[model samples]
Target: MRITRYIVITLAAATFLTGQGMHRETAERMKDRGLSTLDSYEMLKELTGTIGHRLSGSDGYEKAVLWSQRRLKEAGADSVWTEPVMVPRWVRGPVEKAFARSGGKNHELTVCALGGTVGTEKKGVTGRVIEVRSFDDVRALGESAKGAVLFFNRPFDRTRVNTGEAYGGAVNQRGSGAIEAAKVGAVGVIVRSMTNAMDDEPHTGAMRYDSAVPKIPAAAVSTMDAEMLSALLKKDPGTTVTIQLSAQSHPDVLSSNVIGEIRGSEFPEQIVLVGGHLDSWDKGTGAHDDGSGVAQSIEVIKLMKALGLRPKRTIRVVLFANEENGLKGALAYASRDANVRERHIAAIESDAGGFLPRGFGISADSIKFGKLTQYASLLDVVGAGKITAGGGGADIGPLKPFGTALIGLSPESQRYFDYHHSNHDTIDKVHPRELELGAIAMAILSWAIAQDGL
Candidate 1:
């Protein structure tokens, strides 16, 4: 009788464990069904190819707003509308270049005018080039510089683990080279493109003139051309270069932050935000830089609606404008009334290029992050299980003051810098499948958060 009782107890315990395993399998299967039904490819195609590059205050950006509103409405989202915001309107005017001649031969170089730079009075500026590798070198040449164009030929350090770090290292030169050059009476400034690869495509970014220093024309030369110009200058110190930039900043313009929301069934007041900048540098089609992110954000809503999944928390999709030259859209959204700000629970941004979905970089405390990782199995289906805490996109950075948990999508970084801020950041650079995978991962994560109330 004792032996029989022991056998019965062991069997009962095994049966209970088996039943729990089945229940867990059933739950996973339901989650997988939800994930598999989401069509990420079609959504990406409609956004990237249909909308193209959506620079802030440009026609593309406006059209994208309309497209998002219409699509969100069609996707059964509760509401979609535009929020008023002032945006910068900087035009990339005609860029012309002629190399300084020293040996009686003209060396032609490629260049693009930096955003917000003043056009060289119709005829343009011609002067001898003064090359400097670092900001200290420019400081050392203070006062002695007069009517000379300061050339910032700092190359991006390729050894950095994060290419974004390399870009940060070199971007200061482009952003403030004109102002620094003007401090010492320099007529203009030419900065080397912030790129790791040696190419002939000039990267254009926002450059600000210090209110104290006189404003002057500024542009970025391709890395290849910068190197060639440097080598030529070494041989001939008396080389003269002529730069003609037509780019100019127009008056502040009326723009908007496009917002669409799928009202939650239970917690309609609580909100979860997902977004990306709807702007790009005026060079190539801003496909990878942010077009991918914009499209992916939109698709998250579309996919959730198509799957007929009603999340418990309000899911708001925002397509921010002016993230390239300025963060006017992001700022406008963050500066809302206190009542509205208090309702925001979390925000996720995907400004990282449309590369493969490697994982998500979260910016939340241990408790919140621990809860987020519980859904890791659901996210792993879409290839985004690698969740590390600590990182937020620039557009979403301002929301931190509100105590909102910020999260940024982290994709494979192997080739993001290859086309970032370059003319090569076109639609062709992005793989459709990879782009869809990213959107799907975002949708799944957002859905899980909404349902689980994280």
Candidate 2:
């Protein structure tokens, strides 16, 4: 009996080692193909240069949908299609002007209207500028805030090494500043742009107003201008700023989530999902924001096809719509009826900028995380071996309820916020080699999950 047990144990150990060796070999091949071809960068250049920014419900978005479908087909997806989603339509009209008058001098304040802000009249609104650090400060002024341009001048926290954390620490002022200011009868609000960089380029992002309060126009002042305005307010207590915005919110428009898949050889019903949002803010071409992610997601399909590495479970790539202003596409994809028949074992998202690959952030239980870390050896060659906790994208958040394991590709994030939601986020900012490394990392992890279910 002891001899038989030893024989069984030895066979099991050998089998495990053989599987690990094969996976390493496959990862090496993927790295070779990804580095030699640099297909992801070429695809990103075409998408960003040809289609430009794909804000939800715009002609550019529709063009991107068609382009994604064609690219997926070209990449050898067995099936490709679109799912309908209705998205909010907000346009930044031709006029968005702001200036501060202090000490009898007019200083132009670089600004852009936040998405979904109400437009000011043709004459514009001028009011005494009252700079406040937080909502508490706005309330403290009470009646003083009435008819004042409540400037939320909270600067992005620069101490945090993770720029995303720094953005999170300060972005609340931008998202809800208008509602809080309007509640106190403020006429308009000017938020400091959400970036650690002290540049003159204004960044625009989404903001909201409570229906109970009067709607007020909102804009983001450039970080440098925010500092200047703050200094002027200290020097001259009674500084007035004039702002005009022609931003308008129209009816919701129809859009679609682009999807393509390679069917599993064994468990076709089970899926390993990979995705990124297709929509972006209109300030720039969105090359880094999510264009890199979209290209990488599609390139997963290409890489698998090129190497002829078929998995035991399906690999689906979804380019989500309306992620900039809303997650309607994500919500639609995760709806009960849409997912009743499908079983998604895991979902990976690549929304971070096209920077150098560091590792992955995982949202999973300790058991699954431990299992995932076992594959770290395969990824260490590409410099993406680290796996941390609590990571997922806004588009993939909805899938959590379905017991699907969530993974986010974490790139080096120091420079991401400098160009985020601004005109600086352009194609030239991305490097070809860095972009391909990210794709290679994603492909290796995806293949591991598909081949050995977790």
**Residues 27-145, model 1: lDDT tens digits:** 34434543464344455456657766666677877877787777767766778888889988887766656466767788887888887888887777878888998879888997767
Q: Judge candidate 1 at residue 308 and give its lDDT.
A: 69
For candidate 2, lDDT tens digit of each residue in 172-227? 89899999999998899999999999999999988998999999999999999999
TM-score of each: 0.89, 0.96
RMSD list, candidates in order:
5.8, 2.0
User: What's the lDDT of the predicted structure labeled candidate 2?
Assistant: 0.92
Per-candidate clash tally: 1, 0
Cα lDDT, model 1, residue 360 = 86
Q: What lDDT is reached at residue 417 by model 2? A: 86
Model 1 spans with C-alpha error above 4 angstroms: 1-51, 338-342, 373-377
lDDT of every predicted structure (CA atoms): 0.78, 0.92
How displaced is residue 375 in candidate 2, in Å?
A: 1.7
Evaluated at residue 389, the lDDT of candidate 1 is 76
